[model samples]
Target chain A: MDSMMMGAMTQSMKSMPDMAAMDMSVLQACMDACAACEQACTVCSTQMMDCSPACMNCADMAGTMMRSMLRMQGMTAASMMAMLDACIAMCQTCMDECMQHADHSDACRMCAQACKDCMDACMAVKDMMMASA
Target chain B: MDSMMMGAMTQSMKSMPDMAAMDMSVLQACMDACAACEQACTVCSTQMMDCSPACMNCADMAGTMMRSMLRMQGMTAASMMAMLDACIAMCQTCMDECMQHADHSDACRMCAQACKDCMDACMAVKDMMMASA
Candidate 1:
């Protein structure tokens, strides 16, 4: 995410009662990861692979994470936590599925990496929240 | 989610660390909400309201939520919670924006309703997790 967009997101998050107090950088990274993962997974899913189901799911989860960042008003701390868990789960599942054919397909390899990155970002966000809580 | 699909997802989730022990029914509801909201938001976005940005974001988030449900192996409890938060946040943002036009547009009204339902489902998942923990 660019500084200007981050600024816009920050401005938006300020209205969310529970999110205003947290680190925006962490949130930004997670959102970016989600966006990147979505793109990668979308491209990968188009490929004919047995891992298509996982790719599709990862793409959806990543997209969700990105939009969630775009709109913070609906979130509470509890909901945010649950979302993070789901994203992480989705990524891990996708990564594992993609890994099975990573050697044969570059798309799967890249998608798996994106999923890993997304999982890390989500986990970082989770950790940050937990500390504050 | 059909019993067959849920059964497939359950079998997949067994490999995950924190999710195997969790309730699948709550997860399924959340996933279904995400899917419905995504469809609602996508159709609503074509309406060209000032709420378009919010609608776009909501549509993306709903897609992600749906995908996450399809692939359960990648999830962890923490990530799931965070994702739920993000989805709820996105839906709330879309709902609020769409509510501004609800009186004039049935699509916006329906979109808002979908977002609300999705938020409720996400919160239900979060509450269920907390009880388990």
Candidate 2:
């Protein structure tokens, strides 16, 4: 996300007690990873391989996860954790599916890497939440 | 989604035993509703009202719900149920928030209606799933 949008989101989040002390840089990195994963999975899905369905699932989950973070007012910490878990599961599924064809498909390789990055980023956010809690 | 994309999704889904008896029309209606809701919510969020965060959350959930339907191979019945419930909850939250400003904002009014339609569509899909199960 751009600084302006991030600023706006931060400003909005200040009103939510659960989100008031959020680490902006960590949140930003996770959002960026989700965006990248969404894009990569979207491109990979177009390849129409067996992994397409998983890629589409991952793309959508990543997008929703990113948006939910931006919309902190709409989320409770438990819901946020559930969403993060779902996203991580989707990313893992997509990564495994894409890895099977990575040797032959550049798109799949990139998508798998993106999913890995997104999963790692999501885990970071989860860790931060746990530490704070 | 367009007919061609729907057809492709249908074709891909044929390989999934759990989705073999799925009703295409019901899924299509739900997807269309989700798409409309996503568009409406996206537009409404730009208004920068207190409801903007809820609108954004609803939009993302609607989009993910739609895409997940298109990629049935990636979803188990349990996960699908969970997602539908989440989508319905999000739509309800967004609609409630938007409805509060419906008397003044045309955008909020439209977004609330879109959310309502999306929630109904999601419920219909859930009903179909339960009946089939």
Candidate 1, residues B23-65, lDDT tens digits: the string is: 8898888888888998999899889747776787778877766
> Which DockQ-derived CAPRI band holds candidate 1?
acceptable
What are the per-model DockQ values?
0.29, 0.34
Encode model 2's per-residue lDDT on A7-65: one tens digit a residue.
99889788888878889889999999999999999999999658988888988889888
True-structure RMSD, every candidate: 6.0, 3.6
Badly placed stretches (over 4 Å) of model 1 are B1-60, B64-133
lDDT of 1 by residue, A39-133 (tens): 99899888864777667777876776677667666455665676677778778878887899899999999999999999999999999989988
Off by over 4 Å in 2: A1-9, A46-48, A71-82, A103-106, A127-133, B1-9, B46-48, B73-82, B130-133
